[model samples]
Target: MTERATTSQPTPFATRQLHPAGSADVPWWRDAVIYQIYPRSWADADGDGIGDLPGITSRLEHLRDLGVDAVWLSPFYRSPQRDAGYDVSDHRDVDPLFGTLADADALIARAHELALRIIVDIVPNHSSSDHPWFQEALAAAPGSPERDRYMFRDGLGEDGSLPPTDWLANFGGGAWTRVTEPDGTPGQWYLHLFDPSQPDFNWDNSEVRADFETTLRFWLDRGVDGFRVDVAHGLVKDPTFPNFGKHPGGLMEVTHEAPYWDQDGVHEIYRSWRTLLDSYGVPERIMCAEAWVAPADRLARYVREDEYHQAFNFDFLETPWQAQPLRAVIERSLASNDSVGAPATWVLSNHDVLRHASRFGLPVGAPRPNGIGADDPQPDAELGLRRARAATTLMLALPGGAYVYQGEELGLPEHTSLPAEARQDPTFARTGGLELGRDGCRVPIPWTKGGASLGFNDTGAAWLPQPTSYADLAVDEQTGVEGSTLELYRALLTIRRERRLGLAALAEVEGLGDDVLGYLATGPDGRQTLVVANLSSTPIALPEGAQVLVASGELVDGQVPADTCVWAQVD
Candidate 1:
């Protein structure tokens, strides 16, 4: 993809008008550090070997003490669990696996009491194949309104033999799936960008749009602070259903001209949602787009003034562990988001990819496979943890918001040796085990050191088995341990909030080599904090007279060690 030409003149930080901490005038999402909770793997309150809302409610104190401003929960809606709740059968109610609607209500109320905001995931690009609407579409005739709500079209060849287009599914194989008619005849094909169990919605249909609005209101009335819109960029597709000539990667990759993603029509949908959110008025409900678009400028469109309030910086997440590329992504991200008057959201890892800790431990240019197996070359645990801490320290020092995926604070590594039969991700099945899929990263996290399932559930069972190494990294093991990863995270977060770093504006530091990343974050009060990351093989001297605040690793005679990051106060 081509990079957008950036103007040399930087916008004045003062003109950005970032809201002060605790100010009710602006929305809380801006500059907030949000934590992502993969609910099904977070905790199990009912002893059913799966996490539920009550389990999440019991864990709120952990997040509150961790210093995050908000928590973004992945989908726990009524679903068939075909794509881990992404295939939603009912948007209005919680699935029994995750507790009842009353459980959801109590969770929201409890979070509010702790001064924590809640942002639920909303999968609007598609619905579960078993949804009532999709069921109706299946039962209805080809030309019926029920079928119009989804992307249903006649097949290409005679007797409906071929799919209409060659667009590939994000998971694998063809994106189109043929159906059997009520009369037992071969029928038209339906589009599903991911799994066959998920049918893509026809966003052009008025009924679909109206229905999503009602779902939005239903949650807003239930006291949710906002939503994290999944597949935000893929909602509105090119009407022609043009073929994507070459499949780039297994994941939905960065393609500037892909007909199915980053369509301009998506802005209109988000703009409407923005209006709905603003209408609430009191706590300022907001939406963050989980768009994987590219070129920085195009990605910024999702967060334009009248559109989404924030968008994930996947470009940053994918950047290799090199200072030069990391700085480039940071600068471009800040520039693009600044152009649109939005804060750049930084994230290292999530439920989808290999954990950053493991990724950083691999060779500098090694590929980041979705899953790691016993046969795969393992990551260097010591090296990975060191770099992970440094990367997070550098990320937290940057301007704007940040996101921490579940178990990241404990420095959890991916469960590389999960048996094949235990894998549940659709990608693994679709790819015929060639790709191990994301199940490795989504394993249940450890809460206590000794348990049958690492304290994930009361029954000593877990939906996904935990790695034995997790016992050492459990919350109970690291809670009050000095120099532990968990304590390091707490300290970093405390410093980040006290310094108001998230509300500051950053400027690149001159004279830093290609092996080092150096920037100064200047707060509204003119207090400057210097953040420097040494990705080089050797030690780097700290700037003269900079008061050291925190370092990812111990300083070696007043110098930042290799694979280390330091945050300091400077005049």
Candidate 2:
């Protein structure tokens, strides 16, 4: 426990008002560079071998020095760790592994003191089955009000033995799991879009709706600036459930067409939430949706004026390192958000995906699996790191907000060869080795070069083992090294803020090869920041009369080399 000390009103940490290309005034969030802190792997204080609130508080200076306007913390609420804290059993409090309620209050106060706005993860699509509401649903009768909080339906078999639907969990296995009645007879089934320990909440229930509102206010009152709404499009399912009737559904959101995702009804909920956020007024709170819909236009709906403030631009992240497709995704994402009067947000990696460095190095023609297991072919480390740095330059040069995952600045690659015994992701456990799990990306980040846990904790212990390779990429090792990814990122952020480049209007520039990507970010004062990326093997000519601000690699005379990106100031 700790004191939540009040501090003098801090400088604008979250956002700064800006108008680009004659557009509406944009809030600070639109131009902010937000760092995503995965608490479990960030920094372990208290020698518990797990990252906690105090650890994050101690590291606030790292974020401030990195020039991030805000920090988006992944879920750390009380849970069974079924989905690595996404399956919240208690949304109002912190889990003991992370810290206490007083610790959270102190963390928020510290963030404010360091001039960093806080955006916390809010999982509304589901709750841990161990949650009180779900527990009550299990003990109550079929028609009881307790059952209404979650998706519960009667089985169709003669003895009601079969599942209510054939839908499969996103993590694998049947979506519906049946429970036994109090008297030991067969019982109804409950839906879990994820792991069995996580039950999908019924958004149709008024109580469920009101309960999330309470959770939102609880964090906002504690001084959190906003929220990253998890699975934002997966709420408000189709009432007909038509897709599930004739067949057992096992479709992934490969096309974003799943019945459980992107329903029109979800918009109303966000609109109501926007209203709630508006009432808070000062320091202007915001909400971002982790919606995984295809087509930029559809994703734009989540950020409409009356709905959420921003939605993660994931299409760009999944796009291959090809210039044409990458350019298209960036253009489409910005255009779509512009249509909604909202700015787009860019991200290269997160807790769930392969690090871009490794992902970029995979064989261009090989299969792109979610997780790369031990037996998978090793990526071209040199090539991948080069492209990753180039990609980072392109990402930061584009208009709108950006998210930097923990350790990304250090150029930390995913530890793809983790021993099976060290894996803890529920997907890995449930799939029974059929699919490699996200444990690779979730490995605790290395802070220092030496120590059993890479200086993550005082006692050198960790939930996930750090690879020997991590020593070279540890924060301490990369911090001041010239041409290091960490230094590259710091320079990028400094330039981004000093030039207001994040709020610049992006437009295509001519004269680059088809395999090259070129765009100009026009500042409000008419100066331009031109970004040219050479995705091609051959060199590409840079714009004449431009002054280079920074580049991912050394330039050869006036040409941008293959797998290199440059930011230049132009008239």
> Which candidate's TM-score is highest?
1
Task: Give per-residue CA lDDT, model 1, range 1-571, as digits (tens).
Answer: 1322121233222112222222223456777899999999999999888998999999899998989999999999999899999999999999999999999999999999999999999999999999999999999999999999999999997788899999888888889999999999999999998999999999999999999999999999999999999988888888887888555343344555777888889889998999999999977898989988888998988888999988999989988898888978987888788887888899999999999999999898766787888898999989999999999999998878899999999999988899999999999999999888999999999999887888888789788888899999999999998888898899899988887788775667766678988877766555777788999999998777788988898999999999999998875
Candidate 1 wrongly placed segments (more than 4 Å): 1-26, 248-254
Q: Give me the runs in candidate 2 sitting further than 4 Å from their true place.
A: 1-25, 244-256, 365-367
Q: Could you list the CA RMSD of all candidates, in the order they appear?
A: 4.0, 7.5
lDDT of every model, 2 decimals: 0.87, 0.83
Per-model TM-score on C-alpha atoms:
0.95, 0.94
Candidate 1 residue 412 Cα shift, in angstroms, is 0.3
What is the Cα-based lDDT of residue 190 in candidate 1? 98
Kindly give the stretch of ten consecutive residues in candidate 2 with the minimal lDDT sum: 5-14
